[model samples]
Target: MLHHLSIRNIVLIEALDLDFAPGLGVLTGETGAGKSILLDALGLILGMRADSGLVRAGEAAASVTASFEMGALAPDVAETLTDAGVEVEPGEPLIIRRQLKADGGSKAYINDAPVGVALLRELAPFLVEIHGQHDDRGLVNPRGHRALLDRYARVDSTAIEAAWKKWRLAEERLERQRAIIAKAAEDRDLLIAHLEELVALAPQPGEEEELAGERATMQKGERLAGDLSSVQQVFIGSDSPLAELRVAARRLDRIAGEHPLLEEVLAALDRAMIEADDAEDKLNRALDALAFDPLALDRVETRLFELRAAARKHACAVEDLPQKAADMRIALNAIEGGEAEVAALEQAAAEAGRVWRALAEAARAARTEAAGRLDAAVKGELAPLKLDAARFRTAVTPLEQGQWGAGGMDRVEFMIATNPGADFAPLAKIASGGELSRFILALKVALAEEGGAATMIFDEIDRGVGGAVAQAIGERLARLAGVGGGANGGQLLAVTHSPQVAARGTQHYFIAKSSDGIVTRTGVVQLDGAGRQEEIARMLSGAEITPEARAQADRLLEGV
Candidate 1:
C-alpha cells in the first residue's frame, strides 16, 4: 500500500507531501483545484510517461517519490526487482522515485538504486493499478484478458506452459535434424567421391616431411657422385706415388742397419706409403656410399608431389587427410542410418504435441467454466454500480491450432451489451467514459479476490453518477478497501466530487489552489473531522456551506 507521496516543482504543485493510511482514502476539491495535478504527480512514480510540460515554470525539474509498505512482495514483483539488481528486504517499504527534467529527460529509481524506466513500468502492475475513464491498461485492455481469467479461476498454468515449451523444443529439434539430413543427402555423392580419393591416396602423418628429406638427400648424392668418381679414378690409377714410396722405403731399410740416418728415412717413407693406401681404401668406400638408383630418386620425388597436391585439393595439411577420411566415412554411415533417426525424432515431436494438446484442452475447459462464474459475479456487481441495464459476459473463444500458445488455446475477453436487446461488444467500445469507469469498477469488485496490485487508484470513478449510485460506488470502494468483509484488504484511493463518496473515506485529503497575486501553487492537507465536514458541505452547496448542508454531511459521515 502507498504510505507517502512527495511531489516537487510539478505544475502547480511546487511542493507537497501527504501520508496515506489503509482503507479507502478520498482526494476531493473544487473543480480546477489541482486534483488532477496531484494524480499526475503520483503517475510519475507509477511509471507513466513523463511530460516536460508538467514541470513548474522556471523550475529545472519535477520529481515524485512514493513509499509503499510491501508487507509481502508478490513473487513476480520480487523477481523483477531482483533481476534489475534492486534489493528490497521483505516487508520493507519499496520506494519508487521519478525525476522529470524540463528538457524532456527523465530518470527512475527503485529503493534508491538507479534503474531503467522499463523496470519501473514492469513493476508498476504489481505495485499499483490506476483505473481511470481513459485507462488503456488493467481491465480495459483485452490483451491481458486471458491471464486475468486464469488468475480469477485460480488456474495454475505451470504444467501447460511447461508442456508447450517441451513440445516446441521437440519440434525445433526435429526441424534441425531434417535440415541436416536433407543437406547431407544433397552432398552424399560428393562425400563418397572424396572419401574414395582419400582412401586410395592413403596419406600418413610425417610421410611428407620424410619423403621430402629423402628426395633432397638423393638429389645431393646425384650431384656429388661424379666428383667422387673423379677422385676415385686418381686414387685407383695411382699416379705412382705409393709405389715409389714403397720402393724407397725398402732401399732405406736395407741401409738402416749401417746408419741411424738411413733408418729414420726408411721409417718416414714407410709412414707415407701406409697413409696413401688408407686414403685409397676410404675413397672407394665413399664412392660406394654415394651410389643410388636414379629411379629411387624419381619415386621419392613423385611421392612428395602427390602428398602436396592432395593437401592442396583438400585444403588441409597432408597430416589431416587421415582424419578427414574418417569423418567422411562417418557422414556416409549417418546417411545410411538417417531415416531411422528422423523417424525417432518425428515420433518424439508428435508425442510432445499430443501432451500439449491435452493440457491446452483442459485449460480451455477450465477457462470456460470460470468465465461462466465470472460473468455472473460481474453481473451481480453491475446493478449496484448504476449499470443495471448493462449485461456482462466473458467470452472464452477457442483459437486456431496455429495461433495456440503457452497460455493455452483460448482467447478470453470481457464483453458487455450495455442494453437488454443490444449485441455484446468489447467492454472498452461499448460504454461512455462514465459507463466505462463503472464497468471497470464492477469488474474489479468481482475480481477482488484475484491478486492484483497492492493499491488501486480510481480517478473520478464516480464521475457522472450521484445519489444512490454514487453512494453505492462509495460502498463498493470501501468494500474493495476491506472496510468490512471485502475480499482483498488492499488500499483504494479515489479522486471524487461526490460528498457521499468523500464521506466514505477512512482518510481524507483535500487539494486546494492558492494564488499570491502572480504565482499559483497547489497544496494538499489531510483533513480532520471538522475539515472533512466543511469540505463535504462545500461539495454539496457549491462554495457556500449552508447549515442544512453541514447537517447532511454529518448524516453522510454517520451513514458510512
Candidate 2:
C-alpha cells in the first residue's frame, strides 16, 4: 500500500507531504485545483517519462517520492527487486524517488539506493497502478490479458512457458539441419568431383620431398660418374698398371734366390700389386653406387611434377594435400548420409510440434473455462454501475499456427457491447471515455484480490455519473480501499469531484490553489470531520454551501 507521497518544486506544487490510509482515500476540489498535478508527480515516481516543463517556475529541479509498506506486497515483488540488485526486506518500507532537472534529465532511486529507470518501471506494477480516462495498462492492454486470465484461473503459467521453449528449441535444431542439407545439395556435384580426383591421385605424406631429393641426387650422380669412370680405368678397367706391376714382380721373384737385394725388391712389387687390386675393387663399388636406371630419374621427375601441380591447384603446400583430401572425403560422406539425417530431424520436429499442440490445447481449455467465469463476474458488477444493458465478455480467439507463442495458441481480448442488439467489439473501440472508466471500475471490483497491485488509484472513475451510479462507484471504491480492515487489506486512492464519493472515503483530502501575489501553488490537506462535511457540501452546492447541501452531505457521511 502507498504509505506516503512527498513532492517538492513540482508544477503548481511548491512542497507537499501527504500520508495515505489503507481503505479508499478521496481527493476532491473544483476545476483547475491541481488534482492532475498531483497525479503527474505520482507518475514521475512510478517511472513515467520526465518533462522539464513540470518544474515549478524559478525552481532548478523537481522531485517526488512514494513510499510503500511491503508487508502486503506480492511475492514476486521481492524476488524481482532482488534480481534487479535492489535489497528488499519484508516488513520494511520500499521507497521510490524520482528527481527531474530543469534540463529534462532525470534520476531514480529505490530504497534510497540509486537505480535505473527500467528497474523503477519493473517495480511499478508491484506497488501501485493508476487508471484514468485514457489508461491502457493494468487490464486494458491485450499483451497482459493472457497473464491476467491465468492469474484469475489459478493456472500454472510456467508449465506453458517451459513447454514452449522446448518446442522452439527442437524447431531450431530441425531448421539448422535443413539449412545444412540445402547447402550441401547445391554443392553436391562439385564435392563429388573433388573427391574423385583426390582419391585417384592418392598422394602419400612425405612422398613429394623424398622423390624430389632422389631426383636431385640422381642428376648430381650423372655429373660425377665421368670422373669415377676415369679413376676406374687407372685402377683396373683398360688401365695397364696392374698387368705391368705383376710382370715386374714375376721377374724380381726369379732373381730373388740369386741376390738378397732382388728379393727385397720382389716383396715390394707384390705389395704394390695387392694395393692396386684393392683400389680397383673400391672403384668398381663406387661406380655401382652411382649407377641408376635412366627411366627411374624420369619417373621420379614426372611424379614430383604431378604433386606440385596438385598443390598449386589446391592453394596449399604439398604437405597439406593429405588433409585437404580427408576434408573432401568427409564432406562427401555427409552428402551421402544427408537424406537419412534430414529424415531424423524432421521426425524430431514433428514430435515437438505434437507436444506443443497438446499443451496449447490444455491451456486453451483452461483459459476458455476461466474466460466464462471472468465475463460473468465482470457483467455482474455492470448492473450496479448503471450499465445493466451493456454486455461484457472475454473474447478468446484462436491464433494461427504461425502466430503461436509462449502464452498459448489463443489471443484474449476484453470485448464489450454497450447497447442492446449491438455486436461485441473491443472495449476501447466501443466504450466512450466515461463508459470506459465505469467498465474499468467494474473490472476492478470483480477482480478484487486478483488485481495484483497493492495500491490502486482511479483518477475520477466517477466522472460524468451522478446520483445512484455515483453512490455505487463510491461504495466500490471504499470496498477496494479495504476500509476498517487491518494491514492485510489493499489500498485505494481516488481523485473525485462527486460529493457522495468524497463522503465515503476513510480519509478525505482537499486540493486547492492559493496564490502569493507572484505565483500560484497547490496544496492538499487531510480533511477533518467538519472539514470533510464542508468539502462535500461545497462539491454538492458548488461555491455556495447551502443548508440543504449540508444535510445531503450529512446523509452521505452517515451512510459511510
Candidate 3:
C-alpha cells in the first residue's frame, strides 16, 4: 500500500506531504482544485515520465517521493529486498524518489539506490497503476484478453519451460556445429600453403646437426692436413731432415761393428723414419673422411633458411615445423569432411522445426478454447453494467507462411459491437467516452480474479456515470478489493467524482486549492468522521456546504 507522498517545486504544488492508508481511498475537490495535479505528482513519484514544464515557474527542478508500506507487500518482493541487503522494518515502508530538472533530465531511486528508467518501469507495474480517460481499458486490450484467457484455461506454463529447454539446446548445437564448419573452411586455404612449403623444404629431422658435425670434421681434417704438409715440407726443405737422417744412418751402419754407440744411433734414425711413415698413413686416413662440398653447405643454408622463414610465418620456432605441418594436414581433412556434416545439421534443424510445430499446435488449441470462453464471459459481465446492447469479443486468427512467432503463429485482438446495428469494430474505434469507461469496468469485473495484477488503478472510472450507475461501479470496485479470497491480496485505487463512490472509501482524501495571489497550490488530506462527511457533502453539493447534503453524505457513508 502507498503510505505517503511528498512533492516539492512541482507545478502548483510548492511543497506538500500527504499520508495514505490501505483499502479504498478517494480524493474530492471542485473543478481546477488540482485533483489531477496531485495524481500527476504521485504518478511522477511512481516512475511516470518527467516533463520540464512540471517544475514550479521559478524553480530549477522538481522532486517527488512516494513511500510504500511494505509490511503488506507480496512475499516474493519482500524476500528479494531482504536478500539484496535492504533492511526492512516489516511495519515500516519502501521509499521511492523521482527527480526532474528543468533541462528535462530525470532521475529515480529505489530504496535510495540509483536505478535506470527501465527498472523504474518494471517497479511501476508492481506498485501503483494509473488509469486515465486515455489509458488501459484492460479486457478491451488484446494483451489483457490474453491474460484473462490464460487464467481461465490455466495455460500449461510448464509447456513453455519444456519447449524453451528444447529450443535452447537445439540452437546451441546448431551454433557449435556452425563454428566448427567455419573453422574448417578457414583451415582449407591455410593447409595447402603449409603443405607446399613443407614439401619444398624437405629437410630430414636432425639433418642440420649432421651437416654441422660433418663440417666440423672437415675443419679438423684441414688442421691435420696442415700438420702433415708441414712434416712433408720440413722433410723436403733445402737442408732436408730426411737427408740428414739417411747420412747419419749410413755412417752408423759403416761404423756399427766398430762401436756399439754408433749402432744405437742407426737404430734411432730408422725409428724416426718409421714414425714419419706412420704419421703419413694416419694423415691419409683422416683426409679420406674430410670431403667438404660447398654445394652441401649451400643445401644446408637453404633448408635452414626456409625452415626459419616458415617458423616465423606460422609464429613458431624452426624445430616445430614438422609438427605444425602435420596439424595443418589434419585441419585440411576436416574441411574436406564438412559438407557431409552440414547436410546432417540441416536435417536436424528441419526436425527441430517439425517438433516445434507439433507443440505449437497444442498451444494454439488451448488458446482458442480460452479465447472463446473469455469472449462469452466478458459479454455476460457487460450486460448487467448497462452494456446489454453491446457485445465483447476475442478475435484469434492464423497467419500466412512468414508470420510465425513465439506467441503461437496467430494474432489476438479485442473487438466490440457498441450498438445492436453497429458492425463489430476494434474497441478503440467504436466506443464512446461513457461506453468506453463502462466497457473497461465490465471487463475488469469479469477478469478480476484472472491473471491480471495484484492492484488496479482507475482514474476517473466514474466518467459518464452517476446516481445508481455510479453506485454500481463503486460496488464492483469494492468487490474487486475486498473479495481477494482471504489472502490473495488484490487491491484497487479508483480516482472518482461521485458521492456514492467517495462514500465507499476505507480511507478518504480531500484535494483542494490553497493559494496566494503569487502562487496557486494543491493540498491533500486523509479525511475521517465529520471531515469525511463534509468532503462527501461538498462532492454532492458542488461548491456549497449544505445541511441536506451532509445528511445524504451520512446515509451514503452509512451504506458503505
Clashes of each: 0, 2, 0
Residue-level error in angstroms, candidate 2, position 269: 47
**Superior by lDDT: candidate 2 or candidate 3:** 2
- Model 1 Cα lDDT, one tens digit per residue, 1-560: 89999999999998888998889999998889898898788877877899999999999998999999988877788888898999999778999999999999999998889999888788778878888878888878898888888988877788889999999999999998888778878999999898888888899888988998787777777899888877666555435555556667777777898988888888887777778789988877766666667999889888888878888988999888898899888778778888898899999999999999998888888899999998999989999888899999999998998899999898998999988899999987889878988888888888874767788999999988899999999998898899876667779999999998999999999998999899999889999999999999999998678999999999999998
Those runs of model 3 whose alpha carbons end farther than 4 Å from true positions after fitting are 69-94, 136-148, 161-165, 168-172, 175-355, 449-453, 483-488
User: Which regions of candidate 1 deviate over 4 angstroms?
Assistant: 198-327
lDDT of each: 0.87, 0.84, 0.72
Inter-residue clash pairs, candidate 2:
23-481, 24-481
Residue-by-residue lDDT tens digits, candidate 2, 1-560: 78999999999999999998778789999899899999899888778889999999999999999888888556677678877778877688998999999977999988878888888778778778888888877767767778888878776777778878888888898788777777767888987887678778889999998998888778877989878877666655333667777777877777789988888888888888788888888777767776765799999998888888988988998888889988877666667887788788788878877877788888889889999998999988999898999999998899998899888899988889999999998877888877888898888677665756788888988888899999989888877677655333678888998888888888898999998898899999999999998899898998889999999989999987
Question: Which tens-of-lDDT digit does each residue in 443-464 have in candidate 3?
Answer: 6666655654445677787876
**Regions of model 2 farther than 4 Å from truth:** 70-93, 111-123, 185-333, 336-344, 449-452, 484-488, 544-555
The global Cα lDDT (0 to 1) of model 1 is 0.87
Would you give me the overall lDDT of model 2? Answer: 0.84
Query: Residue 288 deviation, candidate 1, in Å?
Result: 20
